[model samples]
Target: MIDLAHTPVTSVPGVGPKRAEELKKLEIESVADLLGYFPYRYDDFRVVDVAEAVHDTKVTLKGSIYGTPSIRWYGRKKSRLTARIDVNGVYVKVVWFNQAFLKKKMKTGETVVVSGKWDAHRLQLTADRTWFGQESEKHVGRLEPVYSVTSSLSVSWLRKTIYGAFAAFGREIEEVLPQKLRSRYRLLDRARAMYYLHFPKGREEGVQARRRMVYEELFLYELKLLWHRKQEKAADKGMTRRLDHEKLDRFIESLPFPLTGAQRRVVEEIVRDMADESRMNRLLQGDVGSGKTVVAAIALYANWLSGFQGAMMVPTEILAEQHLRSLKELLAPTGMNMILLTGGMKAKEKREALSQIQMGLADVVVGTHALIQEDVIYRSLGLVITDEQHRFGVRQRSKLREKGETPDVLHMTATPIPRTLAITAYGDMDVSVIDEMPAGRQPVETYWVKSDVWSRVVEFIGKVCRTGRQAYVICPLIEESEKSDLQNAQAVFEEIAEELAPIRVGLLHGRMSPAEKDEVMRSYAAKEIQILVSTTVVEVGVNVPNATVMVIYDADRFGLAQLHQLRGRVGRGGGQATCVLVADPRSETGIERMRVMCETTDGFEISQKDLELRGPGEFFGVKQSGLPEFKVADLLEDFKVLELARADAAEILEATDWEEAPEYRPLREYLDRFQKEQAKFD
Candidate 1:
């Protein structure tokens, strides 16, 4: 049997400690790890003749190398060798590299089969592989598998180890899949799959085995997610607060302008959801400048009328500050008390804010992730508004709800998601979309120009600043790197500041300290800085009405949604805003991507296309706000599977929640194991 404890790799016949260390680099620590290392390729050698072999040619020829080889040292780094191999009706030269000792093996004419590359120009043979075996030509059977190898590990040792492991207890590792489930899922038994996958008779069988295993892995992962959803629903707290429309109506009317059609529709939905008893966990998605903040403000006001406090959580301190200011301005006429709690707040100011919150003095609390911190409790928090929902996790959302007795949640996203995605990703929650941009919100004009047009681009920003307006210049990096050609925020900032010496300009990047970032952003927002050069840190929540020009350096490096977001930083004022995209002619695909931003300003269209092209991953998401990130099932392609799984989970819960039903025992065990694995491994 393959001894899990004592069977060292070298004991399998060839590998020693030095070789074992090499295998360990490939994550092959034990006999099992080595056995499971699969191949990425296979080579078939079925046809070959000895005499037909020529120099500089790779052929599988049945031949014999009888003459001793001569090795010649070329340079400090190079070596050469030559030998005589007798082939089908002819003789050929066999060449080896740095193996001068092979010269001891010649007696005029001994027979040995060889396989190597043919050098046609020099009429020589370069060894790729060679063997002296029983067969001359007839059916040596199938192709040899070629596995992925690192510099430290060789394919020969890996293959030998797997075969050695299999020789012992190969049958013991076979899957224990239930017959009914296997037949239903059309899956292979684990043992049979391992055999075929590692040593298939042909290509077709190997492919079939791979498909079966991948599908099984995905299916089980999907099934577990559905089970978790069931547990959540069964434990639903169901705390709904009645929102008075007139209380919110007064607050809405207090704003400078009317709500857009999209905003009104979302407001009605939130109010309706809050009006009922089911806890409100809804998503509010819309494009830039779609008026989601006003909708959130009105919702908070409704909570005030319900005799409870409200909380607004955002992704960053800058965004939290922006919301704090916007809510204060929007609700000032209605006399709502809005307070801010961020990481950078003064100790005494934060203490006062906390005291005010606990005593029900602050009507609405707005901040970054700090809003959900312990010791900052509310007397009776009825509503929780999370902006940029993808930035936070599901557990974080639950924690926020824990801050209250299951407070109603309203998630906000400036980047819109597709319908199928909404249904699959946020399957358990209701959705509201602010599809229409507010009236008089002029679309920002865009330009895609080559780097050769740099002079003209600088002039455009200057002209906008000369008109007493501000502008934003964006770069993708913090500093130039030897690995990349993109411009950094600091270099661009310095360059632009010198280029436009008379204008007040500033710099901001992710590496800046939190206090420094806030200070710079504060200056830019207050128009103390007429031009701000930044990285994608400017990708969200900056409201500069006077800034009408946005210049993105290396525009093609950003995704479509990201491009749309950076472009959104402009065009918030009465004058026409311009967003210029600078790129090189060589980046055709990148220009095509940025065109989405130029062609349409809708976050929904761009997000939909992006989701279609690149499915759900860590790169784009709602965890930033307080939503869960999916691991296996895609929000776009496998949306239907999600719906089916969700519904099935619901039915299972209704029949027997918390393992109250005997039929759910298997699934429950699977979930328990899965959770334990994620916790331990991840």
Candidate 2:
């Protein structure tokens, strides 16, 4: 197998020294790197000769050039050249644009063919030559690899270098899948899967090969995850605290509405783990609006009630602020300090908060990554909870644990994972799910609508904002772009502020300084801003219960779980909230995806559906979570394999008493290298 980390791109036979540097510009560095650089698409140009062209028929014609190209320059930087060829008494016109070299290269009366929709031209047949090349055109195939390239490197060269690597080192890469599973899945041998996918002669073959590879990726990812889980769970031998139902019951009853059965189940599971002497490392899986926050709050509050300081870490200042509002309300009667800490606060203010925290005046401290700062000391940190746990890498979570003298960890994610995948990726932690919405939390009326429906929605938002209800308008991009249809955060901000001039408009996105973002969020939380235009940066953070409307532009661009999270941000105040999915329905694919979001709001069910629709590796967002990247597995698609791997890993770990087993030597070595790689990612 090619070790891409140490091997240079020039080592690939065909890539030579000159092309190797150019390839580096594209971030392609080695054999393993090139192998994963799959084609964006396949362009097929296999067809018959042009002599059989009908009057207005569309067809692909491939043949040798039969005539000399004449250069025709009209205006500034304008050019055109045409070639005439006779084939079976039919004269065909071939036109070229700006190919000055072709004028001197081609000889008249050589047999050449061109392809496009045949058109009638003043007593001659004519067609635009969209498909043409030299000798290569003569051997058209069922599938042609179209590569993404810079001007310095040609597609043919890339294809050749990539092809050579696969041919030479393909078999060297180990097959991670067991034989029995491979046969059951009907997957091709690992080498064949790579070869066929890269250079298949036919479309069907390419599809089959790609499917096998994709399946392998999903399966292996799951296995690695489950393996990680087993090791973590097995290593957990520390004492855990229990604050049972009495504490949880009080919080639940204090709420205006009753806790959903799903919420109760998760809370009970949390208490169960806390009661055990072993440290509780658990993941709370819930969808947007699944009431995960309340359940998490209960765990933190329980730890505090039992005389331990609890810490809640969120990904963004906006989310941290949001959690603070909800937790403050929930822990109000409990008289917990419920202190807040974020990177955005004034330096002096932060210092004071730190002083209070060190003084142990803050029982439950909530903040973003600031909680993990080396200078921020904790007093008896017993529990650490991270919302949207995927955003933080494994070591980052462990770092927070270090702050609390090895605090019992609780990781929370609103992203729903399929059962098999969960066992693989989060296997180390026991799973608790908040599957139900609290009773009387009106389901946000959701819709996947085109731009035409927005005028009324905007008016409605204006009305809602006027009535003391806040609205969130989420744009897909942070700023304007020439290449995408999703409105930028800035554009949406300007548009909304213009549309509702009377209402105070606020903007929040990833690009803002943490302090700037915090101020905007705090203003929104205070209801100083009536309408907030934001990017998905606000997806996990920024809780404004009085905000009753969520309008996500380019809604189709987001995955189901994410859209659910954004939707969950609203509907927090118990009053009815509306989730409007504004998207372009011009494309059937875009419309179909949006329809799924509108059809059902169940996060777990949607997560499974998303895996089926978009594959497991993409089950989360496209942004790679800072984990060791796996080349052959996906957590979503290969859940079963994950379960098996996790079980096997646990067995091996237990057998060795956590470090004694010979079987774990290879895995331990891999993990050590992987940990270094993860540091680079950080």
Candidate 3:
């Protein structure tokens, strides 16, 4: 009976091997996969009158066909089925393109229900779905789940197969949550939740079912994270360092700028962590120009003073070089030896860097992934730092630690995350946020304007360039293609150059070779490129304090955190900076996003709004983030449920040994199975 989870999808009624192949495109190969496959949205198929249909909106209406749908041929092979429907003296033409077979199902003066978009241009309804004779009770006047599909699969068929599967096997579906916990939370039974999630009677029941399912997903994820943290704590035997406050102060005072209060507080936190016997696994999160690098340097300096080596890994060669140059200037004055190692370096140069690191002659080494190579050994490595923490996964981070004897790890990200997101994404490590910007750093004045005003923005860029300031023009795509309608960097660069002749514009994109990209970046850094047009590749540590303007075309395509990062590229030089968002959003949500971007430069506040607007999957980028792929949970909408689930898991852990307890057998089994499934992806 337990093998039902892996039963082939073809075993379901009406789903043969051919249909199973189509389902496989959706990652639904087994019964369990089919069950877990969820709808992206729902369509309200409640009955209404044809006269009440809103233009350009999807609606369902019941009416009598005035005559048989006539099949007409056009453009050689194209066919259209056209018919007329009358309801209470209102007549509307209904059309279905390339669906000539639909004409066979309809006859003159027949009662039928159709759901589709009502187009006002032709005074017609484009019928994408129809129910013959009488509306089915299963769908009419109810909330209908709309599954995402491939070209070969239909939502109608998929919905029917799911309903049939539930009728056959719903009772056999295991309840992963313990009965006691479910009762305490007032959650519906597992079988009931499953039924309502896919075939709800109304919006209220649908929301309730979604809440319960989301709680289960978050609860499982939280348990796994908490368990991992517990294990790490049990195994920790970290460095216990004694710091020289006088030496640290001398290094801080020698810096070109004074440290902000927030920076000082974070440095103190690091010092406390390093002095403890347990390993320091902390995440340092801050906004752009919040001075996180300085805090990292202070920690590395403290490690150096304790007679140990330190290493910092970045994601790109340019960022590694930038860090090397900055750290050399800052730490060398205090007699610290810092060396740069990158994959692009000559073989002989890399050999020398590795030799110094192995010989303990180099106090600090900064590089890209080259620092983690097998040949580059550290003699007494006591500290490891990874910048842009999201770029590296858990196992890759562990590989860096393998170089040292479980050295204290400090991960850094400039991405300002919301509170609930921080709790879940970085549950395994302690988090410290530098919420305050350094004194004297100017907030970039942001504006959201229509794309039609490109000429005005270009004129403003020209003015800023004449003042000896640089600018960036970011596009969502690298190049235009037939597949996408978005504006691209290459075309925008040409347009900008034509509009503002002799402005010395440069084009940069991810498709360029490393050498090409580096050359373009060098030009921009030297103030040679007055207007640099590029993609989000420039969103990271491309620091040019001279750049004062950022013009993001189609800015609505970006999330709030991304917009903030792009905005951070400017306002680094302490003078006035501006971020112009050129966008013409179609949806209300898209317009609201632009409003949020223009309202404030407070990253945390922006992040909260972003989380609220776009659910966690989209806000955090489901593909890139370490967050789990949930079937029903939404980090933004179900935050309260997440808190409760976390508390329940903690209570369960403390109450008994869940592995051996009979009441927790189902939970343990589910977790074990989940781990096994995750291992396949790992």
Q: What's the TM-score of every candidate structure?
A: 0.70, 0.63, 0.74
Q: Report the Cα lDDT for residue 186, model 3.
A: 84
Q: Which segments of candidate 2 are over 4 A away from where they belong?
A: 1-16, 19-40, 43-142, 149-152, 158-176, 226-257, 272-289, 301-307, 313-363, 366-377, 387-399, 413-433, 445-682
* Full-model lDDT, candidate 3: 0.86
Q: After superposition, how far is residue 501 of candidate 1 from its true place, in Å?
A: 6.1
Error in Å for residue 440 of model 2: 1.9
Local accuracy of candidate 3 as per-residue lDDT tens digits, 1-682: 5566778888778889899889988989988778777788899898777556788999887777896568889987799889998765677888888888778778878877888998867768898888887545556898889999999888898999998888777777887788888888789877788889998888888887887788888888888777667666778789767878888888898889898888988888988888788899999999888989889999999999888999999988889989888887777776888999888999899889999999999999998888888898999999999999888877778888889986889999998888788888878888888999888887899999898888899899989988888999999998888998788999999998998878899999989998899899999998888999999999988889899999999998888889888999998888899999999998888898899888899888988888888877787777766676677876776778888888888888777577698878877776678678768997
Give candidate 3 misplaced runs (Cα > 4 Å).
1-3, 6-168, 201-204, 228-281, 315-318, 328-335, 343-352, 390-399, 418-430, 447-538, 549-563, 580-597, 604-627, 654-656, 678-682
Residues 1-682 of candidate 2 have per-residue lDDT tens digits of 4455466767678777778788888778876678777776765556655445566765555444554557789886778777776545555666666655556656655545555565654424344444334554544545667788999888888887787887677766556555555676687877787777777888777877877786666544444555555545567665555565675676778876577888878878887777777778889887777777778888887788777898998888767766888888877888888878987788998999999889898898899889999888987888889888888877788889989765778888877887856754554578887767766667778876778878887898898888889999998898867897677889878887998897999998878887887888888888899899998887775567788899998888887777888888888777778889988766665676787788887777777777777764567545652333545454554445555555554444455444654534545555567657767976
**Model 1, 116-205: lDDT tens per residue?**
687666656676555544543332435566788778766776766677667764765634333544675577776677667777777777
Candidates in order: C-alpha RMSD to true structure = 7.0, 7.8, 6.2
Predicted structure with the largest TM-score when compared to the true one: 3
Candidate 3 is scored at a TM of 0.74
